[model samples]
Structure formats: structure tokens, C-alpha cells
Target: MRRVSVDIGGTFTDCFLAFDGSYVEAKALTTHNNLASGFMDALGNACEQVGKDVETVLSSVDAVRYATTLGTNALIEGTGPKVAILTTAGYESTVPLMRARGYGDGLSEAEQANLPAANRPTPLVPVTRIVGIRERVDYKGEAVLGIDETDVREQIRRLVDEGAQAFVVSLINSVVNPAHEKEVERIILDEFPTHLLGSIPIILGHRVAGRKGEYARTMSAVIDALLHDQMYHGMSSLEMALRKAGYKQPMLLVHNTSGMAQMNSTTSLQTIHSGPVAGLEATNYLSKAFDQPNLIATDMGGTSFDIGLVTADGVKFYDFNPILHRWLVSTPMTYLHTLGAGGGSIARFDRMWNAVEVGPGSAGSDPGPACYGRGGTRPTTTDANLVLGYLDEENYAGGTIKLSRRRAERAIQEHICKPSGMDLIDAAKAIKRKVDHNMAQAIFKEVAVKGYNPKNFVLLSYGGGGPLHACGYSDEIGISRILIPPFSCVFSALGAGNMNQLHIHETSLYMMLYDANLRQVLSDFTEFNRTVVELEAKGREDLRRQGVPDDAIRARVEVDMRYGNQLAQTGIVVPFRRMETAADVITLLDLFSANYATRFGEGSQAPEAGVRINVIRVVSYVEHEQLRLRPSEVRVGTKPVARAQRECHFPKVDGAVSTAVYDASAVAEGMTIDGPALVESPRTTFLVDPGWRLTMGAMGSAWLEKITK
Candidate 1:
């Protein structure tokens, strides 16, 4: 039961150690040098908390699970190897053209709506590196034209000559039939040969993504090939480090799929944002643990706010065509949205609304905020928080990063107030209100768009900035209950510790379950069962390769069903592994209809057009025992303890008021702190606005309830 989980974030590296029953959590400033150094440092901190040494903990632990943002940082920094793409001849322009809507793939609605100013992100594979081959395949995998082997060899040679360190082979409808892609790889290997140092790494698009969108599928392959080397070497070094430390078990890496896998079974793309995905996994676990069915998990950090949902119905949401870096990819990543709003988000005057605008632009750790004395002139959300008296200047980030009230005021006044012709206090208030409203709107849209009510869900706030502003945004959306979970700073790391070993495999097919034009339904289960079997076999082999016992593994079959030729695919976890009768087809349709109705609204079902299963997915896993945390019971008659007092301004109040400040460590369990108070922890600050109160719970967890007058 000894295990260690770590989450490498942009600002900090969080570690959670589960030593038998006792859990210890610690954090350290992330050093970008060799990430392992920071990881070791964070783990050392956690071990120290348990009165143990790093070697003792590492050697004794059965497993160490890591959920890192390294892939995300690499994408943002464009630090991967140069890649070359070879696709079907006619589709060479697809990646650059970007589906016409790809420009908005990872942007906010407002940013998307402003089309004229929109610019596509730089291509992961430049046009010069993209070459096409003469090959054609129909949607059904029927070869329309033979794959010209000579043409494939020529394209490979040209790309290699043009300095293509890696190759991505993405042919049309390759998921239906990968003959052409396989042939291209064969030729590449034949020409370069594995024995030679000139052998180029090749990634097949169909193998990477089992879905239809050629552009997205190709991009997935491109990114995978691009980042493959870096991820492999980095993980290998980490594994070696663990091995050297005397750990025998494989280093389990957390995947974004709410699962974990040994290094050998994971792809570079599967690990992107695994940290936040692990946070969602924690939410899922928490929901079952506390019997809280509906929950919205929010992680608000320095530069971004992430939202993930867990419903009472056990319905899972997935994005089949998720954008990684700048490339849209047909990969079923866990459904999560990142809003460009956080503590370091820049706050500026919005002339259009004559209000304020919080950013998609961020003052990252480099210049940070003006209060950090990092030469940042523009005022940010953090500055606004400081000016509003929400954060204690002397105790920010465990007082490691000291804040200057004068700097915050000057930055807000000169950049926001002077420009907007408002006073500093008013400007700060406006910034706070605007940022809260923006976050509220985002949460509202994210949930409402999926056919759920934000009011019905309990908000779980984590991350450094989450609790500080949870009440502000959640209150606007009628979310009265907010729970700051135990070990909030290391929540994601805790999540990584509770995951099962899993592998997902899927394949794209053009199978129409209900052919509206023919007025007939598919009666034969052979094709469907065959595809499911193949995918399951692939997943099983992955786990088997990782040394999982055959009897211990389980599989879940899901089909991405859609009505007609619509873009939206509603994934349905099939009740039975095989569809034996026409009645089973009807059952799937009924389920899809109900789920689709719930999401897109009733009467939105367009079954008259047709019914089809675009992709069949199989999730194979071996369940493991989880480290459970006990929730504290609600206690009455709790009172607040004030450690200090300060004059602070709140937007809800008219003028400056004397606010009580409490050291988070000194706050006893069951104690309640009334509004207009600041709770300072080493990791984060909790600002109890006027009309709200904070109740301290066990394990450093707290609850903030708004007082409705």
C-alpha cells in the first residue's frame, strides 16, 4: 500500500505520499532544470512530513504515479522535435487549412466569435515539411486507388532530405483499413533500415486515432511523432531513476483517460494535462466517497481555470476530437475545459463594454505580477485581489513571494483606473466583479451546454486560486455550497494515487445501425462484435505487456453513436458486450436518444436522418484498491479566531473596513470565521467576502457558505 503520487505544475510540484494508512502531502517550487530534481525535492518534502527520508520512501513504495504538465509546457514552448507529415495526396492542405473552424478549437466563445481578428496557431508541421502520396481510400476502407509504393518512398526520401526528424503517415480512412499506412511504414523501414542511424520514427494516423476526421487524425499522428522521442527519453530516465532507487514495480504514469499505465503502455499524447485530468479523477472518487452525486470540480491556478464535471447519472463526457497544442485530434480525451482566467490573468479596460476584461493573456512566473517585483507594469487579477484586501501581502505563497501593497495599488491605478477614468478602489472592485462574472459565465456555459444545471452541482474548489474566488463566481451562478477538499494543494497528486491500471483502444468504422434511407436496421452482429473484439484484444495486449494477469483485467465496451450524419457523437457504454438481436439495436438507439436529449435538449433527436456508430471503444483495466480519505462531519457552535486585523476594501461593502486575518494552521477544526476575513495558508489564501463564513474542517479542508440576506 505504500505509494507516491506527484503533480508537476507550472508554479509548483505537489507530492502526496501514501505510507500505508497515513497520507502526507508537500510542495516545492518547480525547478524546470531536470524535472526529476523538482520531483525528488517535492517527494523529499512529503517524506520529511512523515519523518522519513527520500531513499527510504522511494525504496519502500510499491508504486510512484506521476501526473505532469510537461507535455503541455512542451507544446506551449514548441520544444518538440521537427516533424514531417505524409498524407493522402489531396489532403496535404488539410492540416494548414485546419477544418476552417480549427482556429477556435481551444479558444473561448468570445475569442471565437471575433473571426476577423482570429489567427491560426503556427502549424506543428510546416507546409514545407508536409508531403502527400498518391493514394485513395473511400469512407468504407475500399481502396479507390492503389497506394503507389514508389510515390511513398519518394515522399519519405524528400521529407528526410528536408530535415524531417520524424514521419507521420496519415492516409484517408486508414482506421477502416490500414494497409496503405502499413505499407508506407514498411517502405520507410526498408529504405532507412533499423540498423542504420538514419532510420526515421514513423507514426500511423489510424493507429493513433480511431475516428473519421482526416485532418484531426493526421494532426494527432504528427504531434505524437513530434513529441514521441522527448517523452520516451524523459520517462525512461525517470524509470531508470526509480530503478536505481531500488523500486521494483514499474513507474505507473497517470493518463488523461482517468486511468494509469506503465510507461511502456502509454503514448506521449495520452499524458498531456494528465495532472488536471487526475484532479477530475479525484473528483470522481470524491463523489462516490462522500455520496455527493453532482459535483463541478474547479482548479484555479496562476494562469488558467479548469472545470470538470461528475453527474449523478454516471454519464461520462468525452471529447473525441480534442485539440492538442494547435492540432485538432480524434482522440477521446476526458472532457475538461480550461478557461484563461486565473490569479495571474491580466485585467484591462474593455472599451466595448466600458467595463473590465480579464485575460486570456497571462503574466506568467517570469515577470509574474507587479507585486512580485518582477517588472510587470500591467495590473493582473492577483494585483486586484491584493488591492481588494483578499490576499495577505506578507503571507502570500507561504510568504516565499512577498507582495507590495503600494505596487499593487500603483499598478491597478495607473494601468486600470487611470485608463478607465475610475478610482483605484473602484477599478479593483470592477476587476474582481468582471473576473468572477467571466468565470461564472464559463462554468454556466460548460455545464448548461451539456444539458445540466450549475445550481444542481456542488462546487469543489482546489488549486491555489480556486477557494479564494470560488464564492465570488459560484454565488453568481446560485451555487451555494462550495467544498475546498483536503490536501487541496496536492489534490491532483492524491488523485494519481487512486487510479486503476487501464488501456483504451478504439477503431473508426462506417457502420450505420439504422439506415434511414433504407428504412432498415443492422441485424448482423458479426461486424460490430468483430470490431469490439479487435479493440478489446489490443487493449488486453497492452495490459498484458505490462504484466497484468489475464483474470484480473476487465473491459468496458462503448460506441460513439450519432443520429444521422451529424458531427456530434454521443458515446454509449453498451450494456451488453454483443448485440444479439434487432431489439439490442433498438435499445442502443433509445439510450442514445435519451442521452442526446438530456445534453442537447429534447426534440433535438434527428433519428429520421439515420443512426450510426462512428467509433467502437474498449476500455480495459485492472482495478486496484484505493487510498480512501475520511470526510469530516459538520459540527455546530463553531466560532472564529482572529490572529490579526487589517483595513481592507471589499466590492460588496461601501468603504474600507477592518478585516480579521487568521493563520490557516491556527484555525481549529469546527471553528467558523465570519465574512470580511482572510485565511492565510502557506500554499494559498482564502478570502471570506462580506456575507460569507468559513468553517474549518479536518485535514485542512474548509467550507465557505454565503449568507443570503
Candidate 2:
């Protein structure tokens, strides 16, 4: 059972090695020059702990799962290949215009509300590169205008003349009928054969996403085509590296869907933020193991904070129109949210309230912080944390990157204290408090908006800066329980170990279950059953192609149900795999109504307007064995080992106080260290403030519980 999992993050590449029963975790600075170098370095560190060499580890391991941020970084760095888009003739402006609300797609509510400053992201596919062909298709897959082959050929030629390296064909309602898209691909192949380097790769809109949003579906295809070459080359090189190192099995890649797939089956969009999604998967495993039915997973890193939810009822949250690197895509990706509150987030003075404001701007790794001596002068959350005495100046990042207290003070005093007319300590305290409140509000909305109570969920904190500030934020939202799981630094890698091989297939259709406007309920069970079966068969075929046995395969049926012409669709997981009886149809309607009532408020149902299933999905999978870690029994003690003592200032307490600092390795299981203490590990620091106690648990896990007054 030897396996290695790696998560390549923005700041670090985390590695987790499972050698038989023992687990070892390691981290290394990410080197963008060659991602494999950083990956190997991190893996080497873990192997050293297990008394193994690189060749021995790679050759012996059953699998090596990777969940990386490469796609995210590539998108942010604008390193993808030049792409051209082709769509229906009338929809040339779709990508540039986006949806009227696309400006707010990936923004905070506050930023979205401030419409004056709102701006759409730069178009990935420019107007000059976007060419359209004559085509028209109705929502029901009926062709209104016949295929214009001559028009398609000319449009491809024009795009090629304009230097289109890639092509996307997104005809209206292609999800329902993809004949026009198929024809366009045929013409593209015939005009420019694959043997020529000039031959462009084409992506059909329906193949990437099975939904009916014209603009979103088109953008999905465009982004996929744009990133295909980059991801393919990157993944292929990695596979070759693994092969050279004596590894044989396919290099399984983790997807944001909470599933693992081979590189051949994964899309670039599926790989974005996969590292954080792995963290969420780890949280789900923890929830089940500890019997914590509801949990909120929070990963607070240097540049972003990710939040994911797991409910007791097993209600899967999905975004039908998710934004991928600023492009709204009609794909039902697993729902996760990222907030602009992290260690590198800049903190500024709020002139209006005479308070403090945290960031939408980050001092990323390149310029870093003023303390990093990279010439960054801006005051950031890290600067505030340093000013508040939470971080050790000489021991940050294992002392690999030294911090400058003077620089931190100057940055804060000049940028925040003087502007707000407050002392440095007060200004730092305000910044911390404001950021915590911001995160708490975001978590509240994430849960409450989905008709769940924040108070009912246990907060699972991970990442470099999570535990340091978990108490500050979770307490603000009235969340009492916090679990910092074992191998918190490599939690996402742990998630990669727990994933099942899965494939999802879906198709868009305009099927009315109940036409309330005309006062009619669908009695056509054959059509309904046929659609579900077709989707299931597609999913089954995908799994079968992946080498899954028929007997081992499992499937779940889901329908995107909506009332009237509403933009929002509620996905309902149907119990019946194939609807045969009227009673089954009635049961589905009841389930949908219940889910709708829970989400958008009761009595919001508009069945009188109409009821329809816009999309049908099937998730096929062969469940694999998982890695299980036992939870430690809670023990009470008041003894602590002190490595050193430092004069630290805490916002909850007045003035500077001498706080005890201990190495995490020194803390044994069942040992407890109380208030005003710092537990320093190689990968992260746990700052235990006054009124909270830290308990060491099994498998490097720790609990930060609030002490009663």
C-alpha cells in the first residue's frame, strides 16, 4: 500500500507519502521553472523520513496522485496559447460582452455591490480572433436553418488567416443538438490536415459542458481549447518523468470534482484549484470518520482563502455556471469559494469609518512583503501579524525567509497607523479583527445562502495560516468547534489518497415535467425514462473505457429542475435510476419541491408558471479503498515544555506580555499547552492566544479549544 500524493500550491509543493502504515509529510518552495523539480524535492524530503530512496519509492508505490495549482497559475500568468473562437454568426460579441452580471462572477459581494468600480476581466478570446459562421438551432435540438458548409469553411479560413492557433465552435443550443459543431470540425480537418503544424485543434461546446447557456457554454469551449496544449504538454512531461523513474501506472490527476482521472480524460478547467478541492475531500473524510455530520473546510494560504462545505444530509452543492479564470462556463463544477483574505492580502486605512480594510490586492511571492526584502512597501496581513507579534522575526518559514520587524513597523505606521491616527498595535489589532470579520461573514453567507446554519457546522482549518487565525474568525461567527486535522500541511494530498475514480456525463434538454401554464402534468414516462437511460449509458461507457468492471460500477441520477423561466436551477438527485411508474415521477417532484423550498425559501415555488428539467446528469464510479486515520481521544493536562520565551503583544490582552514558544515536535500526545503560546512546526505556526488551549492529538493533529472564563 505504498503511495505518494503531491499538491503543488502557489507558495509550496506539499508531499504526502504513505509507506505501508506510516505517513510522512514534507514541503518545498515551488520552482515554476520546472514543476517536477519542486515536486521531486518535496517527495525526496518525505522519502528521507521513511528511510527510502527516490527510485525505491517511485518503483514500489502503487500510485502517485497529483493535485496541482499549475492550471490556476498558468491562467493568472496568462501563459496559455493564443486561441480563436467560432460561434453562431449572430453571437460574435458573446465572449467579450459576457453576461451583464459576469463582472461579479468571481468577486466578493461588497465588490459586486459597488457597481461603479466593476469591470469585466480582459477577454481571453479577443474580438479580432472571434469569427462566427451561419448557423441556427432551436432549444429542442430542431435545426431552424440548414447547415451552411460553405460559410463554415470560409469562417475557418478567415480565422486561420488571422493566426488562430486553436478553434471553438459554439452554435446556439448545441447541447441539445451538436450537428453544426460536428460539421464545423469535419470542415476544419479537411481544410487543414493534422499533419500540418498549422492545423488548429477544435473544441465543440457541448463536449466541454452539457448545459444550455449560450454565452457560458461558448466560453467553456474557448477556455478549454486555449489551455489544452499547455496542460497536455505539462502532464505528458510529468508522466514521462514518472516512467523514467521506474513508475508504471498512469499518473492519476485529481480534479475539482472530488474525483481522480487520468490525464487523457481530464480537461484543463477540471484541474484548476484541484489542490484545494483535495483539501475539501479530506475534510469530507474527516467529517465521516469523526461523526461530525456538518463541516466547513477552510484553507487560508498566503494569497487566498478557500471555503468548501459538507452537509449531514449529503446534499452536493454545485455551480451550474461556474467562472473559470474569469470566463463563465456552463459546467456543473463542485462548488467552492475563494476570498481575497490571506497573509499576503494588503491592509489599508479606511477613511470613511476610521477603521482598517483588508485586501483585494496581494503582495504575491515575487515582490512578497517589505519584511521579505523584495522591495514591497505595502502593509499586508502578514505585516499586521508580524506587528502584533504573532510571527517570529528570525524563525519564519523555518528561518529560510527572515522577517524584518523594523520594515513591518514602518509599513504599518506609514500606511495604516498614521493615516488612521492610531497607534501601531491598535492599527494591527483593527486589521486582524476586520479580516476575521470579513472571513466569518463570507462563511456565514456560504452556508446560510444554501439554507444551512453556520453554527451547526464544525470548522476544519488547514493551510499555512488557518489555525493561526481560526479561533479569531470562527468565534466571530459563533462557531465553537474547530478541528485541525493530522497532516494539516499536506491535507490536500491526503484528500488525493481518498478519491474514487469517477466519470460524469450529462446532456441538456428542454423537457417539461409539468406545464402548469397550460395546466398539464407529463404522462410521457417513456420520454423521461429514455433521457435518463441515455445519460446513464453514456456515463457507463465512459467508466467502461476507463477499465471499470460492469459489476463494480455505480451510478446516480440528477436533474436540473427549474420553475418558470427562472435563471436558477435546483439539481435534484432522483432515487429511481429509471422511471417506470407514475409514483416514481411524483416522488421526484416531491423531492425537488422539498429541495427548492430549502434553498430559495418556502412558498417561492412557482409551479403554476411551469416546471422543467433543463439538464440530466449521471455520475458513474468504481469506489476504491480509502486511507483511514483514527481520531485521538481527548486528554486534559496543564504541563508544557518551553523552547524559548518572547515578548509578544495580543489584541485580547493589554500591552506586551512574555509568551512561551514551544516546538510542535516537543508536544507529546495528550499534552496540553494553554494561552499566549506559539507552537512552531516546520511547515506552519499555531498561534494560541489568551483564553484558548492547544491539545496535541494522534497523527500530528491538534485541537485549539476555547477555554471557559
Provide the TM-score for each candidate, comma-separated.
Answer: 0.93, 0.93
Instruction: Give Cα distance to truth, residue 446, candidate 2, Å.
Output: 1.9
- Candidate 2's TM-score: 0.93
Shift of residue 522 alpha carbon in model 1, Å: 2.8
Q: What C-alpha RMSD separates each model from the true structure? A: 2.5, 2.5
- Report the lDDT tens digits of candidate 2 across residue range 132-223: 78888887789998778898888888887888888888888888788988988888999989998757788888888887778888887877
Best by lDDT: 1
Scanning candidate 1 in windows of ten residues, the lowest lDDT window is 632-641
